[model samples]
Target: MNKYKLYSSTDFLNDDSFVEWLLKSDHDAEMFWDTFVEEHPEKKNEIEEAVEIYNHFKFTSEDLTLEEVFAIWNNVKHKSVEKRFSFLTVLKYAAVFVLVFTTGALSYYLYNNATEETEFTIAENKPLNFNEAQIILSDGKSVPLNSKESEIKYDATGEQVIIDNDTIRQAKKEAEPTINRVVIPYGKSSQVTLSDGTQVWLNAGSQLVYPSVFKERQREVLLIGEAYFNVAHNAKVPFVVRTEHADIEVLGTSFDVLAYPDDKMFQTILVTGSVSIETKSKGLLSGKNKMVLEPNQMFYLDKESGVNYVNNVDVATYTSWKEGMFDCDKLDLSRVVRRLERYYNKQIHIKDPLIGTYKISGKLDLKGDISEVLDVIQSFVPIDWGKQQNGDYFIVKPY
Candidate 1:
């Protein structure tokens, strides 16, 4: 149940969970509304009013594949504005639908209009510090993965960590299994095939920690940075990805998790299947701390403040880094420079903060030199830069 006590039609309809239940018959929605009505009969009239508005909109989600949903959304995109509510109706509100029973199955609804063919653009973000990938084994051996296509695989018996025939480390089954870690620094990334056939692409400056083998009922891993997961489905066993801000309960899905420790926001984008992101909080006025995400939806969490938001976005933009390419749609110059700074391990100072808000879009291959990459960005936007005597680069809006 939403803790704020939704009393308006816009509040109820804006909630993805309410829409899911109304359109898809979600069980949690079924249970939640029933209990909410019983507890607060006074607000019964407002709940019904919200339902009436939802019926007027006539959105449907029965057996529609993700592609079809987007197609329908695109077809109606122009029409939504023509209608009475307009897209303004979907603007920011706390759905807050997850309670103890419902939180387990909660999924958030995103607010993105970009399709797969659509480019992604993010601006004003900072960079990382890295140059290569390293595998830190349980036995204290450090193996360098210098190749672009570096692959690491662990055996099911918790026996070996293999990069080709080279065994980075080995542990006896009789001994206590020590967890291993993979470190991928900026300017480089690596892929790992877990024993269960699950594939993960660790993005630049990301770290993944997991046991050498599966743990009976659960397959859990910790991420200090970003990664793309194609979780091998085992209905009896659930795969969970843990980060500093939230716990992503994998529901047999392919998704991307961006949770860098230095970054303030934690993001998860679902490409296929379903997943629930759960956050915990205490206080009388706090809403149920859960939001389940659907495919093509991205959930964003503000780490320091514990605020949550969801948006519909293209899956390719975030996942394309795994393909050795980076796509920015309309991202601001500040964020683009940050990414470049990490990739090149250099300093880029933007003297005018307003200049960083300028938007640009392009696709750049990671194989290019940092200067060449910066040159590409420069061609599209009105900006100038020069290097100082001490080697730091200063970016400024021309006089």
Candidate 2:
């Protein structure tokens, strides 16, 4: 018999009837059984029991002879049963085996295969961690704040208080303009009180450019990534937030803007007060393309189509980050990853394309470590996470 035949035949050793038939057969059959038992000493008892049952089946049933059983065993072992018997005849033999074994061996085999360990490789591309906050003076110089020897200076402009603690001195200007940019790099965030008494929360990997002070007409600030603003009500001066895709203008209201250059859509959500959004042409804001937004309304602009849509949503989900939590409702995996990247300061890659379309709804404690967030998500998906050569953590599908 071929060695492969013996290996395959071992699968049937647990079947009692097959063992009995093999034991009553000729010397060649007995030699095969002995060799199998010698090769698998761990299954010696099971092999002996199977052989006893085969002998019983051959002798107890007068219809079956030793020669007939041996021929059937040889036919099955060589896979030549098709030449000797029709499909119906083979089915009858199979029915006898099923009656004796009850498919116990096959069931166990399938169970083992189903429980086998599968490994998935997740790409390591996590979010960026902006840890340093700095202010760019009107003279094009960057001054790092949060330093130890910084003195806090107080500058009062109307009702707004400017804390110029040496590390960040407010650029003093009187109307003749210059563009002063405040950069919040990776791994850092900063809070700025604009000249209009509006409070601005700048997230990591973002930059805000504004004049030294607000002019007489409008309060304007250019944003790169994401920010939440609580505008001071000055009915006369409309506060304008400028991003690559759209411009948001409000009289005095609280709102959030998500305008990452890599994002496919620019979103603005109003919590309190009213605002107007203007989509830029060729990525530049100008003219009559402005759309107004009321309280509790969100303005969404498709980055590619240049089309704007308005909808109502639970505002808390958008503003939860400021409160140290991430609350999402039915958001896609890609959108969730984007938020994670901004919060953790690392890049993330989803190796499994199917994961991108997976929709999730949950609240995460933003104050917790990034790994905790990943673990929470892993509960629903089969993901493998690891670091890359560039030191970013990426998530991928498991095999």
Candidate 3:
């Protein structure tokens, strides 16, 4: 059924799926809307008005933030209401607004974007100092989680944070959503339920920055390591996961993103629905600046060469870490070792680079000790491993 049969032009404009249809970003959205218009012929007028309103504005991140665009939009809407004019009628008088806001905002963005980006870059380079998992609130308060796999949930209002058995209330002094961060150290993982009810499984050695509540315009989160997101459905406000290399946008979907700053590659595996990835082109080998992925597909970006590509993949292999299991499907030995290092909080040095290139596949219970997991891997491959004097494990080719 067409869920948006009763949506007004304004509602359609706010809908992420509708915008996706308009932008032709997802084939599923295009198909669904085509069927919707066919079934609800009477909605043609509303749809046309929405299309017109949407097409009239050409705002990008380079020009203005979503808040600024919304402010200008509200001004136009107010004029329409005061004059008792149609949406299009008010747009006729919005030329000056469009020009002035666009030009001024673009100039301001150009002036400050570099500094803003530099600040974040500097922060990203800093080392993680916390020994345990913790949640840092906007009020500069830090709530520590001692559990190895802690569960942190927020109420829809974003003011109440439920960490395990305790509920902590935050003061909401302003209309804007308060920013919060979840930091997970090595050998620890956490699950976070955002204010919007989106479930995020934060893996070991990860950090997630999100609002206590989502804004009307969008729901966005910044991820420093890896996380699996089961985004809540909010057609009116798209959910976006921002990483160092790419911005992934989805109306509602389940996906796993691996973008550890130190890792050589960035990856996104879609479990269901659709997502669009806009890669930040920092180097020459970036294949495409923008792409859309379907379910069961993976988007991979090689940071070293600035190359990215999409391919079909078994979603389970990438997302299983969240489920207390590590499913390896013919993956490289070095890649598997890196994940183990994070999971177990122990350094495993591959003494022979040739041993790291060997492909191995298996499902190992991550709950067991690191040695037990390594024994399982050794059973499947010809490798010898032992602990070093420095208390780290070393893998070598068997004599």
Best by TM-score: 3
Q: Candidate 2's residue-wise lDDT over 1-399, tens digit each?
A: 243244333456655544544534557767766786777776676555554554464322122322243334533544442366454564577655433222111000001112442111111122112355665455444456563112222233422223444334544445435445556765556677766567787776777766555667647777888888998899887787867667788888899998876677889999988888877554122223778777778888876656778999988888887766889888888888888887777888887778888887878886777888888888866677777899787888876
For model 2, where is the 10-residue window of minimal lDDT?
103-112
Which residue runs does candidate 2 get wrong by more than 4 Å?
1-132, 146-154, 158-175, 283-287, 380-382
lDDT against true structure, model 2: 0.63
Error (Å) of candidate 2 at residue 267 is 1.0
> What is the TM-score of each predicted model, taking all chains together?
0.64, 0.60, 0.68
Each model's lDDT comes to: 0.69, 0.63, 0.79
Q: What would the per-residue lDDT of candidate 1 be over residues 57-104, giving only the tens digit for each residue?
A: 634332333224333444344344465654444433334211111222
Which numbered prediction scores highest in lDDT against the true structure?
Answer: 3
> How does candidate 2 fare on TM-score?
0.60
lDDT of 3 by residue, 1-399 (tens): 556878888989888777767765467877777788898989888999999997787543232333364456545544544655465664577675554333311110111212222111111112234567888776656778989999999998888999998999988757434777788999999999998899999999998888788767767788889999999988888888887778898999999999887788899999998999988755222233889999999999987666788999999999999989999999899999999999988999999998999998889899989999999999989999999999999999888
Residue 7 lDDT, candidate 3, scale 0-100: 86
How far does residue 170 in candidate 3 sit from its true spot (Å)? Answer: 0.9
